[model samples]
Target: MIGKLSMGAGAVGAISYCYYDKKATDGNGEKAVRGELLYSNEVFITKLPNTHLHLQYLAAQYHQVAQLNTKTEKFIWHQTFNFPPGENVSNETMVKIACDFAREFGFEHNQYLVFRHRDKPHEHFHIIANRINANGQNTATDRKNYERIQLFCREMENKYGLQVTKSKQKSYAQSSSVQADKLRKLIDKHLPTCQTLSELSIALKKQDVIMYLGRGISFTDRNSGVTFKGSALSRHYSRSQIESRLGKSLVLQAPNSKQIAISDQSGSKNLNTVIKSKFPSQKESLPVSKMISEHNNATETRKDLAKINESLRSVKNRKVKRRIN
Candidate 1:
C-alpha cells in the first residue's frame, strides 16, 4: 500500500469534490452509476441536501473558535491510500485504516470524510480531513508527518499482509530519475565481479549497454538514444568508483571491441596508449584526479548516510519484534 498526504488551503473545495463526486460522469449504461458514497460519520449529516453545508458549518465553528478567519491556513489535509491491483479490500477495512492513520497523525479529534472510489483500476480511498483539531488548534502537518505516514503504512502492510511499498513521496518523486539510478544499480551489480576492463565491457554489452572511457567515462543506453555521465548517474557510479572496483588501468580499446587487455604494471600507461591509439577523436575533457577526489568525498558521505539508515531500520525492526513477542 502507498499513502500520500497533501495539504490544501480550501476545505470547501476539497470536501465538496469528494462528498458529491463533483467530477460527475455522463449518465449512460455502465458509466451511469459509478459508485455511491461509501460511508460517513454519525456526527455529521450524510444527506445530499445537508452534507456540504454541515461540513462548511464545522469549518465555521473552527474559525469562530480560533477568532481568526484565514483562508490561507491550509485548512484541508487530503490523503489517499492505494492498494495493489487484484487486491479486494472492503469499505469497513479501508475506513478502519484511514481512521487509524488520522489518529496516528493527531487527527483523531478532527472531523473527516472517507470516500472509496471504484473508478480507478486499483482499489483506493480518499480521506478529506480538517486541519483544525477539536481544541480549535491547527493539526501538526509537516515533513515529520510524512515520515509518520510511511511508518504507519509499513505497520499496516505487516498487519494486513498487503504488498510492501515505499512511501508515495519517495516512490513518485524519484520516478523521473529512476533510469539513471537503475544504471547505477546495474553497474554496482556487474562491476564488482569483473576483474578486467574487457570482461566488464563484455558483461555490460550483454545487457545491451556500452560504457565508454575516452577523456571521461559514460554509459550509453542502446535502446534509448541517451548518454549519462558516470558521476551524473550517481557518485557511486563515478568513473573513479568504477575504476577503483574494476581497476584504474582499465580502458575500452574501442566501443565495438570484443575483448580488451588489462595490466597491473603498465595500467595508466596502457590506458593512455589505448586512448591515443584507438579513440584519438576523444580527448581528456576533465581532470580525472580532480573528479575522483570529488566523488571520493561523495562516496564517504553516502557511506555515512547508509550507516545511519541501517541503524534506524535495526531499531525499528527490534521494536516491531518486541511487540510481536
Candidate 2:
C-alpha cells in the first residue's frame, strides 16, 4: 500500500474536492463525488440533508473556534491510502482500516470523514480531518508527522495483510524509470557518506544495486536490468561533481594485492606510493604486451558479477510469487 498526507489552509476547497464527483457534469453524467459516504464521525450535531453544505458548515465552525489572526492556518489534514490493483475490499472494511489508521496516527482527537473512490482500478480512500483538535488547538503537521503516517501504514499493512509498497531505496535499486526523481533523492542520501569506490559499491550492493567502477560511473538495478548514470540522475551526482568529493579514492583495489594496481600489478612495490602519486597514468598503464590480457580479465569479472546478480534476482522473484499466491 502507498499513502500520502497533505495539509492545507482552506476546508471548503478541500472538502468539496474530496466529495465532488468530477464526472457528473451536465455535458457528461459523471459523479460529483465518485465514492459513497462510507463513514463520518463528529462532523455535525444533526443529520444534515446536504453533504456538501454539512462539511462546509463544520469547517466554518472549526474556523470560528480557531479564531486566529491570520486566515491562512493549514487546518485541513488530508490523507489518501491506495491499495494494489485487484484487491477486492469492501467499503465498510475500507472505512474501518482508515479509521484504525487515523487512530494509530494520532487523529483520534480530530473530526474526520472517510470516502472510498471506485472510479479508479486501485482501491483507495480519502480521509478529510480538521487539524484543529477538539480543544481548538492546531495540531502540528511536519516532516516528522509524515514519517509517523508511514509507520502507521506499515502497521496497518501487516495487521490487515495488505500489499506492501516498495521503499524508495528498493524501488530505485530496481531502476524503475518511473521513479527517477525518487532515485535521485536516495543517491543524494547515501553518496555523501561513502568515502571510497569499494565502500560505495558495498553500500549500494546492500541496497540490491550494483555500482560499476569503470571510467564512467553508473548504477545498475540488479532486479530490473535498468541502469542510470550519475550525470543523468542529478548535477550533484554527476561524475565530475562526485569525483571532486570522493574521486581521489575511486580506484578499486585488487584483492590480495598489497600494491595499488588497475588492470596490471605484477611488479608494484608499494600500493601506498601509487595512491599517493595521485593516479599517475604512466605508472598505472599496462605494458603494451600485457594490455590485452588485463582488459579481458576485467571484462570477465564484470560478466561473472552480472550472471550472479541475475541468478539471485530470479530466486527472489520466485519467492515473492510463491508468497503472494
Candidate 3:
C-alpha cells in the first residue's frame, strides 16, 4: 500500500496530461464536453460526454455547491493497486470497485475508469475531475481525498475477502545507496580469491545477494546495495557457467564462531595484500559492480535533485518576471 501524490503539472505531468488529452479526442468528440474524462488509452474513451456539466448540475440539484472566483484547472488523479495473487477480480471489476468506493465517499458526481495494461502484470486505474463545485469554487483534493480513498480500498478488501498489502513504511529507491555500501564491503572481501566469475557469485550468494539478470546481471543486497553485471566479474564467463559454480549446486556452510574468525582474517589479509601489491600507476583493479552501482545511483540522485530544485527556482523567477513585465 504505497501512495504518492503529484501535482497535475510537473515532472510527472506528462502521463496525466496524456490521459486527459486522449479522452478529449476519443471517437465521440461531440460528447467529450459533457462529463470529465476519467481514463483513456489514446485510442479508446471510457466516460460519457457532458459528465462534468452533469456533475455540476447534480451539485446544484443537491445544493452542495462551493463558491470559487476562477475556473479550476482540470486535474487527474491516479491510483495503482497491487492486488494480491489468487484474486479473481478482472480489470472491469476493479474499476467498478473504485467507482463504488468514490460514491460511498460522497463523490457521487465523479467519473472513474479501470484500465488494463497488457504490458504489465498489475491492474491499475485512474480518476479525473474538475475540482469545481456547482458554485464554481475549487474543491480541496488533499489529505482528506487520500484518507477517503484508503478507507474505501480497505473496505473493498474486507467485503470481497481480497488480500490487501500492508502499508509500505519505506521506499526502496531512496535507501538503495545504503544497501550499495554494504555490498561494496562484501565484494571487496571476496574479490581476491574469486579467480572465476562463478566463485565471485558463490561468495556473493553466501552473503544473501539476489542476482537479477536482464540486459546485464544485477546482484542486489536486500539490505543495502546492488552490483551491476560486468562490474565485478568478466562478461567472458557465460551465465550458465557462473550459475553452475554459484547456484543450487553448491552447499553453503553457515559461518560458525571459528569460521567467522578464520574468514575475517583471510578476507582482511587478502584485501591488504591485494591493495599493497598494486603499483600507484599500474594498478590492475577489476571492476566491482557493487561499488559502480552505488556511485552511479548517488550521482543520479544528486543530478535529479538539482534539476528539481532548479525547476522550482525557475517557476518562482517566472512569477517575479511577470510582475516586472
Number of the predicted model whose TM-score against the real structure is largest: 2
Worst window of 10 by summed lDDT in candidate 1: 167-176
- Judging by TM-score, tell me the better candidate of 2 and 3: 2
In the range 127-156, model 3's lDDT, one tens digit per residue, is: 433234444544435444444555666777
- What TM-score would each prediction reach against the true structure? 0.46, 0.48, 0.33
- Model 3 TM-score is 0.33
lDDT of 2 at 153: 69
- Candidate 2 ranges beyond 4 A from true positions: 26-31, 45-53, 68-72, 167-325
Task: Arrange candidates by TM-score, descending.
Answer: 2, 1, 3
lDDT of 1 by residue, 76-194 (tens): 78888888888888887898897788778766776677877787789988887776665567765554554477788899889877778755432112213767777777877787677
What value of lDDT does candidate 2 attain over all alpha carbons? 0.66
Candidate 3, residue 109: how far the Cα is off, in Å: 0.8
